[model samples]
Target chain A: MGLKEYAGKQIEIDDDGFVVNVSDWNEEIAKAIAAENSLTNLNAQHWQVINFMRKKFTEDGDTPSVRALGKLSGVSIKELYELFPKGPAKLAAKIAGVPKPRGCI
Target chain B: MSKEAIERVSIIISKGSLEGVYPGLIMANGARMEGIEANLFFTFFGMDAINKSHYENIKVAAVGNPGLHIPTLLGCIPGMSALITSQMNKTMAKLDIPPIPEFLEMIADSGAGIYACQATVEMFKLKKENFISQLSGIITVGEFYQMAAGGQIVFT
Candidate 1:
């Protein structure tokens, strides 16, 4: 893990670039991370997924899997891919300031 | 670990039994979850995985499967395969693993390519309609190799 500046704050990040502390997350930091990952826009739909991920992580202590995200996040699996591109669950979890989800599906 | 990361994977499923098929499906799905490109090639009896009639009813081979720990002689009894298959299905469900058809759908929606072998389709008198809609196409070994280019090839 290492510290990197986002939204003018030095936040710890993991090797894969996920935020190390969930508490350090803010809208500005999320936007900065999203911009760095080539997601220039965090529209309402994008916020829907990001907020859902953060809520789940806060309540359940882990991010949801892709299948769970598709079924429960009010975002279809195909659209989640559209929003996050390569890996929906992992990317969304990263942007939401959560650890990478565990599980295959 | 190698300095180079795996960017893509081609998994070949050549068996029809439940145990034989899930490994390939799980691996391909796992690859997609990791942001790696994935493709599944179903050949020979593995076609049952994509076959419209058989994909949902795949059985566990009770006979000659030492993992089951049952006497081989008893495996020949009627209903043995069905009994074991139902038990395994319940276990998988408890683990939140979807059924075969649903799993295939999830993999496809994740943008992994799913295909059936051309030679196997011909030998089995199968057509496009025989496969699940998630199938990318009926492709030959050569075409599969093209999809597998620049990636790891796994057989399960």
Candidate 2:
């Protein structure tokens, strides 16, 4: 794990740039990461998707795919891209402070 | 930037068998998950994966498949393919892997490009309407090569 400083706090990240410790997460970190990804604002929809992914990761030990996120998060994949740009699943997971999703992330 | 980032991934699915098709599907999904653009081009019998009526029917091939390590005679036994397919589906479901249609929906929803080979489509007497709506287009080999130029290409 690599230590990165953001918002005056240290966070652990994997070689792949995914967060290694979820407990080190906070709103500030999320916002910072999102901004780094070119998402300027975190809206209700983005929050919904983020919270949903965090919850799923906590329960399932794996993140849902974009399809599942679409069906369950009430956010379409196209909209996810609009929100997270190139890799919505990975970028969203990163902002949500979770490990990158395997298949659909 | 060394290789900077992979901008796109082009997957060529050349077989209709589940084992062949799933690899491409899985990889494309993985690529999109990583924030890279993924394009899947189905060629030859691989066209079955995009055929709306037939996509869901793709079955695991247990016969003469060295990957399975089953004895040749055992694989030749009747009902082996069906049994293998059933078992594979069960395992996939246990892992929460989506079915064919759902996988397609996910890939497309992830903004990956899904294309079919024009030569294969014509050879199989298939039309644009015969494929699922997720298909971006029926492209010629020239077009596919053009699409794969300078990007990663996977032949599955």
Candidate 3:
């Protein structure tokens, strides 16, 4: 019933402890994440931005703030709302293949 | 089009106003966020924005900006530029955005390229060392256009 019990049952934890396999991450979540990260679906823009953000985190050891992410993609912070209606952390987490951000809850 | 199919964009930072500098930096930064390679070429007065000493310190002209209204008496006043710039900086800081220097650093760290216009640099007698450390290199307009050629070019 609690989070712990679900961990090893129907859901499994990935190596990073960021997300658990829900088996229902869903197409809507997928599409929202893709758009939020700027993936065109034509050439994996979503994956590229997500990968670049991951690389930046790996090298800089910091998740880029929204402003920083916006700058990198020539998108405006005002415009970011259209991509991730749930916000970047939520959307980016999904696209980056990571779990939702810890503080998001 | 797919991300792989789209060409990267080149952003031109051409304005000298205090309000003008941020547009170029922000745009370039945004381009990188979208996974696009972005290059910023600062020329003329725009050069002052990237120069280490002046960029952080520059202020907007409050009276002449046309958007600002401080009464006609203040329009002709000599110190209005400082007043407007100071107020603008306060607003930006409150918004939690970095001031220009730190913003430029953020852009550089994000893999956004910074370039100083060679002609503008020479005309102003600015040496490479005068620029912020973020610069990829100083280059000619032709070279800048070459990098920008097929890609989208934005002038801010």
Q: Top model by TM-score, which number?
A: 1
Off by over 4 Å in 3: A1-64, A67-91, A96-105, B1-6
Q: Rate the local accuracy (lDDT) of all candidates.
A: 0.93, 0.85, 0.66
Model 3 local distance difference test score: 0.66
TM-score of chain A taken by itself, candidate 2: 0.91
**Cα deviation of B61 in candidate 2 (Å)?**
1.7
lDDT of 1 by residue, B1-156 (tens): 769989999999999999999999999988888789999999999999999999989999999999999999999999999999999999998877989999999999889999999999999999999999998999999999988999999998
lDDT of 1 by residue, A9-105 (tens): 9999999899999999999999999999899999999999999999999999978999899899999987887898868899899899999888766
Per-residue error (Å), model 3, residue A82: 25
Interface RMSD of each: 1.2, 2.4, 9.8
What DockQ values do the models have?
Answer: 0.74, 0.61, 0.07
How close is every model to the real structure, measured as TM-score? 0.96, 0.89, 0.63
Identify the candidate with maximal DockQ. 1
- RMSD for each of the candidates: 1.4, 2.3, 10.6
For residues B9-122, what per-residue lDDT tens digits would candidate 3 score against the true structure? 788887778778887777776666555677888989888888887887777755555678567567668877777778888887776668888788766766668899999988
Worst 10 residues of 2 chain B by lDDT: B1-10
Task: List TM-score (chain A only) for every prediction.
Answer: 0.97, 0.91, 0.48
Identify the runs in model 1 with alpha carbons over 4 angstroms from their true place.
none
